[model samples]
Target: MTTTVIAGKYVLGMREGRQALLQDHYVYVDGTRIEAVTRDAPAAGQAVIRYEQGLVMPGFVNLHAHCLRGGLFRGIPDDLEMDPWVPKLVYHILLPLTGIAAKELTPGELHAVTALGMIDLLRGGTTTLVDMWHHGQEMFFDVAKEVGLRTVGAPFIMSASNSRLGEDGNPVWDYGNDGLAQLAKSVALFKARDEGHAGLAQVAIGPHATDTCLPELLRECRRAADDLGCLLTTHFAQTPQELALLRSRYGMSASEYARDTGLLGRNVILAHAGCSTDEDLKVLADTGTHVANCAFGFAREGQNFPYARFARAGVSTGIGTDSHGMDLIGELRVTGLLSKQFFHQAHTGTAHELMRAAT
Candidate 1:
């Protein structure tokens, strides 16, 4: 029963890498679905918004975003380049709130933070985001539903109680029992209650990071995701120090380790694959895996991803802002520039290549 028109000089689709340029155009939206995109109005819509400048395109999608930690832990630098230690440092230094602390909130603060994070993303033209945060996931879901943004709520789950594995390859939680049983139930409840409620919410599972999830836990999570027919995301090969730890513990790369535990495939998305090797890249390409390149954030930490290597390997690379909030456009531009410099080849990662990746 509702209709509108959005006219801009150019319209682009980041996913499809296509742009429709028009001196004068109109887009008619029937309820939520875009009904028609034409140079002239159909004379049926209720509202017509004419944008003089700025590209009108489908909003960007941030594949890996952390809403709760983004706002609560912003501007706190805990020396992230140290690999395995960085995670421990971040968790200990920024011990925000969880378990007992979560119960203390009256639901208002949770809603506020959720709205605040989504508002920032929406303003940046991010229509959809996959968020992994340990606290206030329910409130986050509610806010996304209300705001009409597509959101995937992934609660941080782990099987290692002590946050690190022991020398015997045994996880510290439940003696390898279901350490994330509560988290699993929470995910199921949220899915059952809100999966299709507002056309804005989907349930996903994030295994935190490799250093935090043991082999058994990762396998179990993968099986669970497969059975439920959902998406699975994880942090893999984030730093050299982390890679060293994995090598010491299992004598294998983190990518191989994840694959061994059944965590690599089309449905699985990895973030910050800075430490991946050539063999790891082959596995990723063969598995049809998707990667979110946080090149700019890593650039700040003095770590540059192997963008040329990844592109050569035929891996589908998507751009992500992480928690930097600089917008995808800037990230995309920086990625292209960095790749060109890293490879020392002018034609390696051109602007059009980066634009195609972003789109």
Candidate 2:
């Protein structure tokens, strides 16, 4: 491969010991890896590309996202709150259409929609993302490889039940016994797609959420993650209804249930966590579990994560676009602002801290 040098007027990157905005820096690239970054220009006879006045920085990482859903359902059911919003828009209308799309859409058509989402992420300067969705995950992997983005594909695992609000404004669950099969499918996906992908693609276990997965199923997911040597992630404590249901069913908070099931660990990534109580945050901090804060989606419902408190409690927090149009840049800004509002203090969640979460 030919060597290339890229020069920028300003480079926002790490220098010496901390974050620094460098001036007149040139990056030396050879094939896939960056050879070096320096203030001095490259020696004579090297291919060079110069950005006269641009801020060059590392690409963002979206810690949680749903790519297919983001692409297929961007502007439907726009103005609604969380409670009626989920059942009426998501479970009733969108989810069934997803199933139909899986069966009806051609491979080319499916890949096109999925690729549009990935392209949106890349165009927005996101170089890596962790995506969880149902159906056509293998197609998602193919698109990731083609697009040259580092992706962790997690297939959604929902085994115990599919719960949605009935006409009476209460949950109606349709139970099933497909947990073991889904776990097997997840492991097989990891072995087939993740093992020999040269680190460009990876796989993780995504047990849908506490409300959808039984305790035994979650425990098995933990063991599978350990055995497969990959990350285990799930949706936890995202809504008041979920919290109430978990407490009623298991007699514990969502975080407590996760801890008891051996699901809280260094390798575990919990998405949302908007409803995690103070005690739950302590348990998360104690166990070294990470949280993916998808602020934009929740903020639409007039809610926000306790990200500042989580950061102060020593919990590693990262930014995720979740289902919010794949605008990681916007998510970062919202995360920083929401943290300050949640803590009722300025600079409580500094820009540096939120940037660390995204990258």
Candidate 3:
């Protein structure tokens, strides 16, 4: 195999159980794999590309995102809390638009929008993105392949509720066949793309949210994920309205319902546990469920996630943009600052800890 040496002024990586910044380091790449990274010069006959002034580090892994509709719904729903926001902006406005756009947009248009999001992700140094969206899984896989980024696409599956505003301006529930066909289609899509994509792409089951899916559906999704040996992700306790809905409907907290329904596990990655309680956090910790903390999106609505609490509770936490922005560096900075401010202790969220979450 052909080998190449990339020499940079500074290399930022791990060494001896700590973060290290090495000066004048050379990284050796043999075809697709990294052979070595060291301060010594490459062999005499090896091809070398030198960067006089740059920092090289591992790429960011965005644990939660929605690429297809991320750029499309910007600026329309601003400065609103979850109560009015969900009914008016999300259910009434964005949901219908998403369905229409998914069907009506031509292939080129779909590719263009998806490519724009992926480019923004790459420009912000994100090498891997886990995205959940409605419709167009194949198109998203195609875009990820074209952009040469590792991606996990989870096609959205909704059962009891479709997130539509009723005549009374409240969120409505459909409660039909529990979206079993959609789940099956998603599993089939996972096998089709994940098995054929040469490891560049993967698939996960997305059940939308706790308030949207039925109990039976959630249980079946967990079983399917275990059977397929893939990840299962959902939005958990994202908003106060969601918490209220869960309490009223199921007489249980979001995390309680999830745990009882067999949804909490190591393979499950939950997004936006901002409204989760201490009990919910305990459930997450005990079950080894991973939390994807996206600070910017929730902060816009005048809220903050319990990231520091999650860290302290021994819950595996990672940073994400949540489709609000693609800049992982900015998200990392915001996560550190917001977490510190929320806890009123600067040492609670150190730069190193935040960097660890991002990576």
Candidate 4:
């Protein structure tokens, strides 16, 4: 056990909305978890690390981020439309980058790239990151552990969707090229070694998106998360095309489809739920489900965020970078601006509300 004192200008805890301003605090750490957080300074015999003009806060939790893609595809502007731009971007940019290939990059190269992303995240004060990548689970997990950050990694799963264009000009298939056994192996590996030195590793079942997954496979993933007592996350209602496809196939909206399929509950997080309707928002509100919106990136691609509907529906909304960039401040700032522009109301998204979403 070790004890230290830090004098900080601001110490914010999201748990109870606790804030300590311009004060000296004592933190007792018995290994990982903080044993105690006190306003009082440590005794005269104790050591102290004081900061000037610095903020000491619990690590930022990034609800949604793709670590590798963010580094590889950053700075390329995306067209608002997804029809041809998405495909072109993938094949022309991402697919050509050998660095992203799990088998292509040597241990050193992979570590370096992963480190690049990790360092940027840490510098920005993000302590927890939920990442989806194209590499092997073990490799990313190992690198994340070495960086001393909390991680939630998911194997990117896809199924039965031939519409999406991969970088190699081929259809992106489901989780495993072999079969269900491969899916089992991925889930097992994540369950086996997700924990690391920082005590911040967690495993979640990640299906790529609703359009890519078959109903049976999605159901299986939901069951697996429940059995493992972990989180189940997927992309849903990201675009109008996806919404139309799900409705046509399932005879209901995407959120409604999830509800009917028994996937609309706690521990399930749907990312980029921009196309959800008013009714769909109500269901999400009642179910205690969470929506992580990448408002900055999605809007950069011309997708409008239905914040008014979501707020009116009483849905608990969180902000994400969605692999574009992990600038929490930028995301929060953009969210506030977008809300005012979208609703034609200057008072739509207040600073306090935006801060709550980002923090």
Q: Indicate which candidate wins on TM-score.
A: 3
How does model 4 score by TM-score?
A: 0.84
Which residue pairs in model 2 clash with each other? none
Per-prediction TM-score? 0.82, 0.90, 0.92, 0.84
1-359 in candidate 4: lDDT tens per residue? 67556656665443366333434555555556767667776777787676766777666667788776666567765653455323344334543453245667677877777777777787787777877764353577778878876788877665631234556444355434432443575588666865633456777788767766667778888888888778888887766656776777788888777876556788987886888888888889899888887788767766568455576679878777776776776777788788888888878877666656655
**Model 1 backbone overlap count:** 2
Predictions: Cα RMSD each = 4.0, 2.6, 2.4, 4.0
Q: Residue 205 CA error for candidate 3 (Å)? A: 0.7
The reply for model 2, stretches above 4 Å from the true place, is 1-4, 29-35, 81-90, 160-163, 166-173, 196-198
Clash count (model 2, backbone only): 0
Residue-level error in angstroms, candidate 4, position 318: 2.1
Each candidate's number of clashing pairs is 2, 0, 0, 2
Model 1 regions more than 4 Å off: 1-3, 13-22, 30-36, 44-46, 78-106, 161-178, 194-198, 306-308, 345-352
- Supply the global lDDT for candidate 4: 0.68
Q: Candidate 4's error at 266, in angstroms?
A: 1.4
